[model samples]
Target: MLSEKTVKDLIDNALEERSDLFLIDLKVNPDNKISVVIDGDNGVTVEDCMFMSRGIENNLDREEVDFSLDVASSGATSPLINTRQYKKNIGRTLAVKAKPDLKFEGELTDVDEAGVTLEWKTKEPKPVGKGKITVNKQAKIMYDDILEAKVIIKF
Candidate 1:
């Protein structure tokens, strides 16, 4: 059996080489098998998994050890919008899904480790007729208040 230090060193070196392409999350199961979840810049394709698996296998083989390994992308429903996530998406808009299927379109003004600060657009202006004036309003929404959020790409 390969020691934990040996395995960690192998994984760290292998992953650090491709730091720009992917992020690795390593875990050890109760049975001592290793499970690695990889977060790629884009979605993880089969080729990526094969390449990573082969690399890890070759490294372990060199060290002469028997250990189980799994390589996979995040496969998360949504990217973790932690402080890091927010910082990465700075100056970009987002589509926020709130409770009860309510959605809000807003621009991300600030973000922290705990949550994001969203400034929802005020109400649309009404026609300047002989009737009512437009009511422009803005609201601040916390990250906890958001159910789902994704970057809104603009063409």
Candidate 2:
């Protein structure tokens, strides 16, 4: 078990120190469990997870607490799932292949708790009945959902 203040402080400090790895959010659920979400650099690897886990565990252990831990990285083609993730990706181009087999690539222009706005331009003429759509940010993904995402550099 862990105290909220303690967990919050630990997460905040770690996120601050390793900002290159975006600290999306943290929560101590009602079940008294701690959950951490982190967004990493484009090339985050297994080593990154190991580093974060050790850092978090080391600090928490020092406080005389025990808990289960899990750490992971954003996949090369994972969809941006939350406002925090989308904000971190602002100004970076995102390519998303949505359901119904639509492929789109665009600059991330805005993000909110509700959804995200992408400034996408297609080389071909617009398809019939194809209108601009806003995709709500999901906290997690399922296998059936289709999406491919990556950060593209644009000034």
Candidate 3:
């Protein structure tokens, strides 16, 4: 059986060569099928995935233990799983699904160790008038409360 630690070490070595890259997830199924998902501070490229794949394939002895490796980047629409991901996405609009059946769609204005701040405008009825007015609204959501968050891409 191929060891997960061995695979992880190879991935770490590859990341050492590229400090901007970070590991998002790693899975080693019972069949020795290894899946590695990575992300970068700036972004991931096709070359980055190839580099990571070679890093693992070149180091392993496939003859001794036949194994398969799949290296891929976190998809553009994938949910944000790391704090660094949130930091990189600052200023972008995010559709956040939070706890207690709450959802928010706003520009990610800030990111801290604990959570993020979203700012957006909504139409609200005026205090002394019949017509509605635009009002600026913002919320600070804790990381624990966030069920999922994805960058809302706009054409």
Worst 10 residues of 1 by lDDT: 129-138
CA RMSD, predictions in order: 5.5, 8.9, 1.0
Error of 2 at 17 (Å): 2.8
- Top lDDT: which candidate number? 3
- TM-score each candidate: 0.53, 0.50, 0.96
lDDT (0-100) at residue 129 of candidate 3?
64
Badly placed stretches (over 4 Å) of model 1 are: 1-4, 62-64, 76-119, 122-155
Candidate 1 yields a Cα-based lDDT of 0.64
- For model 3, residues 1-155, the per-residue Cα lDDT tens digits are 88889899999999999999999999988899999999999999999999999999999998898888899999999999999999999999999999989999999999999999999999999999699999999999999999999999999
Clashing pairs in 2: none
The runs of at least 3 residues in candidate 3 whose Cα sits more than 4 Å from the true structure, single-residue gaps closed, are: none
Worst ten in a row by lDDT for model 2: 137-146
Ranked candidates, highest TM-score first: 3, 1, 2
**Which numbered prediction scores highest in TM-score against the true structure?**
3
> What is the clash count for each candidate, in the order shown?
1, 0, 0
lDDT of 2: 0.63
